[model samples]
Target: MKRRQIYFILVLIACNFTLGYAQNPFEVIEEPLPYSKKASSFTINIIGYNEDFVINEWQKYITDFSGLTYVTAVNKGVVEMESSGVVFPLLNDNKVNLYTRFAPNKTLTGVLLTVWVQKSDGTFFSSESSKKEAERIKDWLFEFQDKIRLLNTRIKYQQRF
Candidate 1:
């Protein structure tokens, strides 16, 4: 199953550009909708690019931001990154692992990407709080998604005009 996933992942791609102004060559599939507190995973689509382009974008996004992210794993085309100690404005201090998987789009445009939070330590002294922790995770994921969305907008606008 793992090998099969890698096979499917090969089609998703990202750009080879450097950090600073680099944006993933992608378009948002949909906006994030409401999910229950128990919900952890959020699926977003990055369509209209080649296989390797999207994947490259993800790798650069994670690695280039040295202080913000730490690369935990990169297998096949799956990238697992852990957040730094920077606590967000959420109710608690909980560091999170950002897990992302990309599957080739059936339409042959881009990829179906699912990103989620898992296996985390309470940030800023490691205080364990379930309620606050869950909210923190969701908020952090949304913030990350928004960053990508903004970047995609820049990419499209610049490419066109």
Candidate 2:
């Protein structure tokens, strides 16, 4: 009787472990959403030239970003982007966007891309899409980066002056 009980207990434990460690379907086969991870607690938004497209269409092009791991859902793609240091905010819009462009490595239009992190937290951090209110999420991403670059240049000029 004791031997049977022990066997049953072991089997139950094994089943429990399997269930707990089962692979997540999203991680296994889904394309990650286009977003950049600068580091812990930081993400950037990416944008493309032809920004508007069906959500499904977006899924087809996730491979453009080599550093990011992407997973696709019914409508949105989740991305696990690679980063080494702290992530800085590039934009202040609410939602993050991923954009693609030409890449030398790959023979695809809009093959290369970049990301920007919007900053519309408004006191509380909410994961809501703010694309509607801000019509040009893609343009904003570039403009935001340009502004950062310009600011850096001005700082350097001032230091030299």
Best by TM-score: 1
lDDT of 2: 0.34
TM-score of 2: 0.24
Estimated TM-score per prediction? 0.41, 0.24
lDDT of 2 by residue, 109-152 (tens): 22123333324332211123433322343443345435544655
Question: lDDT of all the models against the reference?
Answer: 0.51, 0.34
Q: Over all chains combined, what TM-score does candidate 1 have?
A: 0.41
lDDT, residue 120, model 1: 44
Superposed Cα RMSD, model 1: 15.0
List model 1 lDDT by residue over 1-161, tens digit each.
Answer: 99988866664432222432344433322223244333345455555555456656665555544426545776665555555533334534334445566667556565666655544442221113354555454454455556666877899999998
Highest-lDDT candidate: 1
- lDDT for 29 (candidate 1): 26
Could you give the C-alpha RMSD of every candidate to the true structure, in order shown?
15.0, 19.9
